[model samples]
Target: MFDSLAEKLQATLSDVRSRGTLTEDDVNAAMREIRLALLEADVNFKVVKRFTNAVKERALGSDVIGQLNPGQQVVKIVNDELAELMGGESAELRFSSSPPTVILMAGLQGSGKTTATAKLARLLREQNRSSVAVAACDVYRPAAVEQLITVGARAGADVYERGTDADPVEIAKWARERAEREGKDVLIVDTAGRLHVDENLMKELAEIKRVTNPTNVLLVVDAMTGQDAVNVAEQFAEVVQFDGVVMSKLDGDARGGAALSVKSVTGKPILFASTGEKLDQFERFHPDRMAQRILGMGDVMTLIEKAESQFDETQAKELERKIRKSEFGLDDFLDQLRQVRRLGPLQSLLGMMPGLGGHQLRNLRVDEREFDRIQAIILSMTAEERRNPDIIKGSRRIRIARGSGTNVQAVKALIRQFGQMQRLMKSMQSGKMPDIGALMRQAR
Candidate 1:
């Protein structure tokens, strides 16, 4: 998300960490570069100033200067202050004690409020509260209500949509009532957005708020909007007094300035970040993990969480048993591939690994097409041949190659790689944890 900024910050911190001692002059010089990086990343000027000042004050304090590994201590200070600037802790969605907790979604045109609404419903469903109702109040756009309906269907939630003829306030009120009657636990009202901030939009939103009496007002901001996002958030907060901010499009090459500045600018915590268009791509915000990501240290906790979510414990244990017995086959290999794919794109997964970003993986493109080819090759093998690859003689290899529509050499390469991977898995199963850095070095 903040790839460029992360790279720059990592380099700057590495340089500082390499030094034996840190002086005020050294800290000032580093802060100057960091300030420029933040400005270039489109962080709000005021937020950047405050952030740098906080970092500077802490860096020059007695705890850091002339201490052992002063450079590292200073970097730690920066990370801590950056996390504090964004909000020291994650904010949880506050459910009303009364039935049908109303959540008002507000944002500008194309800010992904509707999609986030569905994503939020899906998140709530994961918590075992499945009765979610989406109220579409965006009557300005012709298909806005329909879009919300479709999203609601995808999220397995009920939709409270009124036609274009109804006033938004009335629609919201009716939707709330319907949710209460239906025994829904939560009501999400997707409000309309304007091309630009104006009196009419604010008045309409205010009217909706008056009618719905939402328990939480969330401002959805596009991370790609950079510094301008802060102003938009502030404007919305002034009118609606939003409880929190949702930063969308963290999967893009967003410099992350909006994410860094929004909380400080709006005086609200960032509750969630939407990484992609997929329903499950949204993640709850964590200040410490975000701090690690911003410093290019890799978010190990988030990575582990993602892995745990995607990896099946039973399947993993079965695979371990197969590897221990030296019975790992092409079928197992295919299963592993699917598990890795489920985690996320291969590049993103690798990028989260320590020391595995930027040029380190410049040539590895693990797209669906590559997976398709591998799967086709595996599918062409007979069950017996897959179980015991040694049984595949020259004639069998030719038949398999023809079936897969690949050349003989490609088939041979796949077989060779599969054998090596099986051996590696066996070694790992035997308690030999391979050094990932060495593996990358070998790949290079």
Candidate 2:
């Protein structure tokens, strides 16, 4: 999501890295560019000034200026400062020694708190919190309780709602009691939000906090709101004193101002972030990994984690066997596509890939509907036709194209792409990385 800033910072730092030696003036110039980039990306003014100053001091310090790779040292200093600016380490939700660890969700209207609550539950489930429960206390908004229940079901967490008519605080208390009685490991309370920060909203949330005595209060902030999100978080922090923030819609936020400024402005860590709309799209925020990503160094650890969680091991082994035997087909290609989709958006994955950012990422736009078309074309074919794509000649291609609502040319392109993928895998097996330069020349 730090697309613009990442691009600018990478370019500015790449110049420094190219130099064999560094002068103080060179470091100053780079820091100037970084400061501008952060401002352009809407990072908080005070935070930007402090961050740039820290980075400049480290960049021009004797330790870095005397180093064999002074330029690299400067880059490392920036990376370290970025991590520290964002709280340095990952912050996990603190649970109590007692049962039913309460997590109070707080945010403004249109902040996507309801959805973040569900995503948090799903994340907890991944961490072995099997008996997670959620209390839908957002009784002010219409259908808020029902929305929580629906999303809560998808997250595999039991939802307790005393209907919209009941007092939110009382409902939260009752839900906590019920969760404790039922032996739920965690109870997440979805609190109501208003269009603006108001006394009534604060009072309601404070009352809920007083009644439940939540272990963690997470403020859900929409990353797309940019600096406004930081302002809202600052106000919320003063009133409700949240433990951390959950940044939702980060995938859609190209500027990433909220993420970069939240910790600095509110003095709270970003505990979690929602990368997409899917329930599984949320994840624990790791500042170090995020700093790496923002600096165009890539987040290989996060990428590997996503792979370990979403990629099928048995299917991967089978696919390897198929590639070695030249048995990989359109069926396997489709399966691979689906598995990749499970890892979230393709563009987000590309950002996590080493040496792929800035202009390269901007040039590549992942169209999910293309996968639909490919699936349709494959499904329109017979079993034999899919097993052996060579048999699909002129008339067969036309028939498949019409059936799949695509042109015959599109069918031909799919086959060609599939063949290229098979060859690419075979090259990989030979311990050689096949270059996709030609394929990537086309933006589509």
Candidate lDDT scores, in order, read: 0.79, 0.81
**Model 2: residues with Cα > 4 Å off, grouped in runs:** 64-68, 299-444
Strongest candidate by TM-score: 2
What TM-score would candidate 1 get against the native? 0.67
* lDDT per residue (tens digit) for residues 1-444 in model 1: 898888888888767765656899999999998999888888889988998998998888847322125666677777888889889888888988987899999999998899999999989888656589899899989999889899888998888887888999999989988988888999999988888778998999888898888999999988888877788998887777889988988888459989998888889999999999999999899987798888875543344456646554565567667778887787877776666566665554553332343334445554545566677777999998888777776988898889988767667767766666667777674422122323323322
Q: What residue pairs are clashing in model 1? A: none
- Per-residue alpha-carbon lDDT of model 2 for 115-183, expressed as tens digits? 998988988888865689999998888789989999999999999998999999899889989999999
Model 2 misses residue 218 by how many Å?
0.6
Over all chains combined, what TM-score does candidate 2 have? 0.68
Clashes of 1: 0
Worst 10 residues of 1 by lDDT: 431-440
Error of 2 at 243 (Å): 0.6
Clash count of each predicted structure: 0, 0
